[model samples]
Target: MHKLGYFYLPSGKQIALEISESTNKYRYSTNKDKVKFPNIESIIKLFDQTPPFDNSRNLSHFEQIREFTIAKGGRKGFTVYIYECEFNKMKEIKGSPFSKYGDGHESLGLKRGSRVIGRYIDTGKKYKDKYVFSSISLINDN
Candidate 1:
């Protein structure tokens, strides 16, 4: 299983966190699997370098995030998963305007446990709508 970690945010604030590894190690079950999945040590280092919004302690092992949820401004009636970027480099790749509108890697939404280096925003208008990590970015601690 591939190790992935996530910190939950409500109203742009960190509440709780969870760390887990995938049961299927051969490949990601979803299209958004390209995002890097970090192991235990990498997770800790990332947290230490970035620090948590809540200043709460870090998870000791991999598991599920049970204490965090979507904030009010978030998509009002949908479920969202938050994760940390296991890898540091995420560059934008242009694709068809119809990208993510068909099937397979082209259409599948972000995996429930997938990690992205960007922040999330909800306009309270849709369930499958949110922003992606941008090419013009911030937070470089490598």
Candidate 2:
């Protein structure tokens, strides 16, 4: 089992998202507007190739979330955000890519979080404990 990514909401809820390989153009621009969250593929790769969490089981959900976000212009307009998960904070033994993303020393940020919602089951593993957060919609509540 692999642990790719995870999420925690502001309500103190924790979940482990899934990750999967996608073969589609992430970002796209039409004659009308440019997709806000472009390069979703890159983002997935970023999430996948990042580190410690790479082998985690959260990759599938993470990749799915990324796809949904990109399709709906993530972080743009109004988004129906669900649970929020903090990866870097839930550290175990070895260092993880997510933990290093926002260590207050990297260019990412001091704190990194993602919004999602789904059924999560606890695995009780040292670091394999998993959660499932899944849901997709437009940013404008459409």
Candidate 3:
């Protein structure tokens, strides 16, 4: 693995926000009415609502994802947020990722902290322990 990016949010509870790969398109919109938060329903669906019901906890978790990088900004109503997370690519030592599991091979300088429900930066979201964040963004030079 290789360290390619980082996320400002807490370490767990992967976020699946969908944004266009085009930077120009991100800021430029023909429609005057723009929604600040899109795909909110989709984000809500990722939570668990049964037994020990963590709906509120999960919802709060999803909201903590801060704006890592402004993908596009202008005179638009709302700015397009593009967060990046590439901690998985980092090289690990010869041991289990979790200390409780085996010899444990963490703190290789890739992840800032252990996989725990750390409160996200400023957000009160008690994120889970290292949820596999999917559809993470790639650094866009263009």
**How does candidate 1 score on lDDT?**
0.31
Q: Write the per-residue lDDT of candidate 3 for residues 48-89, one digit (tens) a residue.
A: 322222334544433322222233221221211112224644
TM-score of each: 0.20, 0.16, 0.23
For model 1, residues 13-85, the per-residue Cα lDDT tens digits are: 2212122223344255565655334456755545554322232455433222322222322233332322123
Candidate 1's displacement at residue 135, Å, is: 7.0
Q: What is the lDDT of residue 34 in candidate 1?
A: 51
Over all chains combined, what TM-score does candidate 2 have?
A: 0.16
Candidate 3, residue 135: CA error in Å?
Answer: 17
Q: Which stretches of candidate 2 lie over 4 Å from their true place?
A: 1-59, 77-142
> Which candidate has the top score in lDDT?
1
Off by over 4 Å in 3: 1-12, 15-38, 54-89, 99-142
Candidates sorted by TM-score, descending order? Answer: 3, 1, 2
Candidates sorted by lDDT, best first: 1, 2, 3
| lDDT-better candidate, 2 vs 3 | 2
Total clashing pairs in model 1: 1
Writing each residue's lDDT as its tens digit, candidate 2 over 1-142 gives 1232323321112112222211123233433543233245644544454332333444576675565445645544221212223463332212221222123112222233321111222222221232222232212423
Tell me the whole-model lDDT of each prediction, alpha carbons only.
0.31, 0.30, 0.28
Q: Best-fitting candidate, measured by TM-score?
A: 3
